[model samples]
Target: MEERIIIAGFGGQGVMAMGQLLTYSGMVEEKNVSWLPSYGPEMRGGTANCNVTISSDPVGSPVVVEATTAIVLNKPSLDKFETSVVTGGNLLINTSLIDRKSNRDDLNVYYIPANEIAIELGNVRIANMVMLGAYIEITKAISVDSVYKAFEKVFGESKAHLLPINKQALEKGAEAVKSLVNA
Candidate 1:
């Protein structure tokens, strides 16, 4: 199984971190993975995105022009990468920050209130983790357990205290998607 994903958002929104976590999680699962991140010079509030590929076999490239899934964290990112998802692909949109809905009809679109969920979890930074959880539930591309194991590798041991909340964020995200799917 090969999943080519494009995660886009404003800088400082944990776009690259999500990509790295997915790559690391894939590694933990013994899958071939690749992560490529890009950010504008301004960073922080500037645009940022990453391309990730997880597959059973070797990854042929890290650049994803047509993604199997597109996780958009902001309006601009939604506008930019909405069409980048292949027909019948998945589009995970963070609706807490985006006001509009996707125009496409061919894709399996999921609207996740990531920021709202993160806020409910007591921190807005883990909004990305919320979105990541939704992606995992929708695709089953990687296991949440793998993500837990790779957490320290990406965020470092200094931030270990944050794991419980992050885990909650991931679970909340998955639950959110499950409800959406059921509804």
Candidate 2:
């Protein structure tokens, strides 16, 4: 089970966080994982993305030329990585930020209202976590339990107080995707 994932969004939107969460969660599950982050010059409000590869076997490279899944958080990201997803792969779009839908029909496309959900959850910062939850539900690439375990390591122990809310956001995202697919 090899999952090559491309997660793209504007800087400060936690694009790298999502990638890292996935990579770390994969590691917790004892899977081989690689994470490569890229971003524009500006730290915030600029283009930022990451390529994550998780598999049962050794990862040949950290770069992902073609992704098994593409999670796009904004319009520009959607435009940039929509075609990167392999046929029959998953394309999870944050509908809260991206106004349009994908033109491709070859993949399983899920439009999740990530930002809106995070806002509803009382913190817009967890929007990335929402998307991460959606991806986990769709792919089952890593267990939700692993994600919770990796949170403290990723966000650090000082911010451990935020764990409960973040966990809610992840569950909300998973619920959101389940409804989307069930519909």
TM-score for candidate 1, residues paired by index: 0.96
Question: Weakest 10 consecutive residues, lDDT, candidate 1?
Answer: 38-47
- Which tens-of-lDDT digit does each residue in 67-157 have in candidate 2? 9999999999999999888999999999998989899999999989999999999999999999998999998999999999999999899
**Model 1 Cα lDDT, one tens digit per residue, 71-133:** 999999999999899999999999999999999999999999999999999999999999999
Q: Where in model 2 is the C-alpha error above 4 Å?
A: 39-44
Residue 139 CA displacement from its true place in model 1, Å: 0.5
Question: Residue 49 in model 1: shift from native, Å?
Answer: 0.2
Deviation (Å) of 33 in candidate 2:
0.3
Highest lDDT scorer: 1
